[model samples]
Target: MTRRLSLFGATGSVGQSTLDLVRRDREAWRVGVLTANCDVQELARLAIEFRPDVAVVADESCYGYLKAALAGQGIECAAGAAALVEAAERRADLVMAAIVGTAGLAPTMTALAAGHDVALANKEALVSAGELMTAAARASGATILPVDSEHNAIFQCLAGGRIDQVRRIILTASGGPFRTMSAADMAAVTPAQAVAHPNWSMGAKISVDSATMMNKGLELIEAHHLFPVGLDRIEILVHPQSVIHSLVEYIDCSTLAQLGSPDMRIPIASALAWPQRMATPCAPLDLAAISRLDFEAPDEERFPATALCRAAIAAGGARPAQLNAANEVAVAAFLAGRISFPAIVDTVRRVVDAAEPAAPSSLQDIFSVDTASRAAALRFVEQYEHA
Candidate 1:
């Protein structure tokens, strides 16, 4: 059976990884659509090769470039936000919601509203709008498969187990490149050092998030939404090996875990061929060859982003959006060398503290708060620059 598929953020790391898998087995999927934020060249290249039914670039200014690149190729080319949402509305068996940040939220919602099963890679879509997203999925009868490694690991472990018998879920982290660095060392670290992830290769924004342990914080929120678990029941363990993806505890006090090499394709392949297995060209995990796995507690003093996020989770409503929005702004500032690395979390704290978060009545409400929070966080960045 050929499954119809659409990919949002076709030029991103996850999207590229996904393409690598799908392109190998072209007969298995009908490429319904492919969309990229602004990379017209890459978008056109993928379109020419894979030949999706439709191609969209979020940067409307590049529409002419993309269209000219795909001329006479029999693929429809579109540009701008409306086209992205309209593409999501196209009929498909599954949609890959991999558009990185909050920009993915609307198209993800559109896919769910259209009742397509979504393989979600956008952490912000769940972190900032979990309640709304889950509610919409419930109403639309759409399934959301977690593509993040931790959540995907827990998902596999929880299979054949009842939710009631589950005790807690422990998510492991590589702790980025600063697990052992002192507070003073982190304060003086540059963007180059912060983005040097020890285990994972990711985009700059996500790499920065990992350095501050904010990615783990964001993933904690995502897990809470994905699983029927309380915020306090979720724990983060710093496992530098990145071998054990995640663990789930049952009533018997035994823990079940999913182990794999640090490869994104493993989980993504699992999501795409769910309820069935697919062969991926990834190396098998060899436990004996890899000496031993070390585990320890994440230092809250050095990485307080998680602690701050815990507060926002407890606060509920629009606070998570505020926290995520602020962090994105602060990360951009740090990446641009306008602020110190420590100022990333500090700026997030200041903005989250000042926001008067309230219950979001609609998706637009979430957007309003997100916009306001971004402005507030930028002000913090300016403060740090002038200080």
Candidate 2:
């Protein structure tokens, strides 16, 4: 049986990887919708090849180009944020919510509300609106399959087990490229250096998040929502090898882990074939060739983003949303050369600290907090830029 599929952020790293897996087993999926944010040409190229029922670009201005490119291809093309949400509501057996940042929240929620199974790769959706997103899933009977490698690992580890039996969920980090760098040395790092992850290939924003260990922090918050494990029981370990994706410990003192090469497709494939297995072109993990694996505690002093995220989730309410918003702004600033690498977390810390705690009850409230946080983060970024 062929599963109908809708893929958001079709031009991104995760989207490309998902498409790669789909390409290998083309007969297993019927492409319905594919979306990207302003990459009209690439989106058109993918739409033409995959021949999705419709292609959407989030940026409204790019609609003309996208439409023209897809003209006579028998694939409909649309643009703007509304189209993204509309596409998510389309009939599909599975929705791959791969759009990065908070922009993905609405469409993801739309899919869940429509009772579609969502393969979630966008951490910001859960990080920013965990309660609401989960509530929507519960009300609509939609399943949110974790697509992030760590959460997916825990998902696999907990198979046939109850959450109550779980004692701890250990998420592994690659420690990025600056695991051993001193604070002083890190302060002088460039965006290019920060994005050069040691083990995984990713977009610039997330790559920088790994450099500051913020990605792990965001994952921590994401894990809390996904696994329902107490935030206190969730821990982070710096595993430089990137072989062990994550671990879950049982109350009976047994630990279960999912090990794979540092390939995004591994997790994407996991979600794409939930309760079943799929084959990928990735090389088999050779334990002998990569003989040793090492683990260490994360250093919060040098990379305080992880700790900040813990505090935000602990505080609950608007803090995690604020933290995610500020971090997104700060990351954009760093990438644009508007602030120093160290200032990225510093700006996030300041903005999150200064934000007023409030429980966002609706998507509107979350966006309000996100908007306010971004403004505050930009102000802090400017202060750092001049200093």
Candidate 3:
């Protein structure tokens, strides 16, 4: 049986990895829709090869290029944000929501509303609008399969027992490239240094988040929504090897963990073929060759982002949305060399502290909060830039 697949963010790292797996078993998936932000060439190239029913680009300006590239390929092409959402509504067995940041939320919701099983790679969709997204999933009977490594690991480990029997979920982090750097030295870190993740290959934004451990922090908020595990029961541990993806403990104190190579494809494959398994070219884990795995408690004093995330989730209303919005602004500023490494979290702290918006009841409310939070964060970023 062939599963129809609609892949959003078709040119990204996760999208590429998903395509790699699909390419392995070409007969199993019939491509329906493939969307990208602005990478017209790569998107067009992938569309030509995969031959999706329709190709959509989020950037309207790139439509001409994409259309020209796909001309006469018998693949319909569309552009702009609305096209992306419309594409999400198209029929498919699985929708891979790989688009990064808050931009992914709407289409993801659309897919869920259409009752498509979503392989969610966008953390911001859940981080910014967990209740809204999950509510939509519940109302529509759409299953949200997590694609982040830690969340995916927990998702797999939880299969051993019921959610009620789970004691705690332990999310492991690589502690990133700056795991051992002193707080003093971290103040002077460059964007080049920050994006060089030691374990996984990822885009700039995520790599920087990993360096600050904010990625794990965001994952913490995401887990709270996905597992219904009380925020207190979920914890973060620094495991530099990245072998033990995540661990779930039951009432009996037994821990179940999912272990694999640090490749994103492992988790992607898991989501792509849920309730079943698919083979990937990824090398099997050689535990003995790895020599030893190390673990340590996350140092909150130096990496306070995780602590900030906990507070955001606990506050419960608009704070998580604010936290995500501010972090996005701050990360972009840090990458642009307009703020120091420490200033990233500092800006997030300031924005999240000041914002007291009402709880978001709808998608519009979430966007309103996001816009206000971004404005506040930008002010803080400006201060840091001039200081």
Candidate 4:
């Protein structure tokens, strides 16, 4: 069965990994559309390699560059957010949503609105507009497959059990590179040190989120949305090895885990094949040679971001949207050396505090809150820049 596919954010880490897997079995999938943000050259190169029906670059300024790169090819080319959203409606059997931030929220929802199954890699889509996206999926009978490793693990573990039979879910974190670093040391850390993840190869922003343990917090929020579990029932453990993707404990006391090498392809393939398994290039986990696996409780004092995430979840409504929007702006500022390490969460905390989180009944509401949060976060960054 040749599955028609569309990929949004086709130049990021997850997007590149997906392309590696697609290249491995290119004959098994049809490339309907491929989209990227400002990476015109890579997008055009991918267009040449895969010959997708349409290729879109999210930055409107890069349109001519992408168009010229693919000038002679029969593949249609487009640019800007609307073009990217339009690509989501191109009649693909599976849509891979790998766009990184709140910018991805709408396109992922649009894919669902167009009745496409989404292998979702964008946590912001759920973190910012979870109810909206999940509701859109249900209304359109669209399946949302978790592409994040931890959520994918829980999905794998829950294969046979009913939602009611679930007792708890445990998500493992690498504890990141700074799991043991003192808060004082973290405050003085550089962007170079922050993105140096001990376990996973990720983009700069997510790596810093991991450094602060906010990635796990955001994932906790994402888990609440993805799984049929409450925040109290969802837990995080500092698993330094990152070999155990995640765990599910049944009401009967059976804890089932999905174990594999730390590789995004594993989950991407799982979501792509789903119900039926698919092989990935990740090395098989060697249990005996490694000898042991260890887990510890997450240190919330050292990582207040976890507690803030819980607060956002408790606050509900537009608070999570604010959490995500503010965090994105904060992370970008940190990456650009405009904000210090600890100041990242301080920025997010300030924005969430100012939020009057009302339940959003529409995407317009989410975007409105998102816009305000970003504006507030930028103000915080600007103050930090001068101070």
Task: Say which candidate scores most in lDDT.
Answer: 3
Which 10-residue window in model 2 sums to the lowest lDDT?
A: 351-360
lDDT by residue (195-265, candidate 1, tens digit) is: 88998888889999999999999998899889977888999999999999999999899899999989899
Candidate numbers, best lDDT first, in rank order: 3, 2, 1, 4
374 in model 3: Cα distance from truth in Å?
A: 1.1
TM per candidate: 0.99, 0.99, 0.99, 0.99
**lDDT (tens digit, per residue) of candidate 4 on 13-122:** 99999999999998889989999999888999999999999999989999999888998899999988888888888899999999999989878999999899999999
* Residue 280 miss distance in model 4 (angstroms): 1.9
Clashes of each: 0, 0, 0, 0
Query: Cα miss at 207, model 4 (Å)?
Result: 0.8
Per-model RMSD to reference: 0.8, 0.8, 0.7, 0.9
**Candidate 3 C-alpha lDDT tens digits along 55-168:** 999999999999899999999999998999999999999999999899898999999999999999999889999999999999999999999999999999998999999999
For each candidate, the alpha-carbon lDDT, in order, equals 0.92, 0.93, 0.94, 0.91
Candidate number with the higher lDDT (1 or 3): 3
For model 1, what is the error of residue 164's alpha carbon versus the real structure, in angstroms, after optimal superposition? 1.3
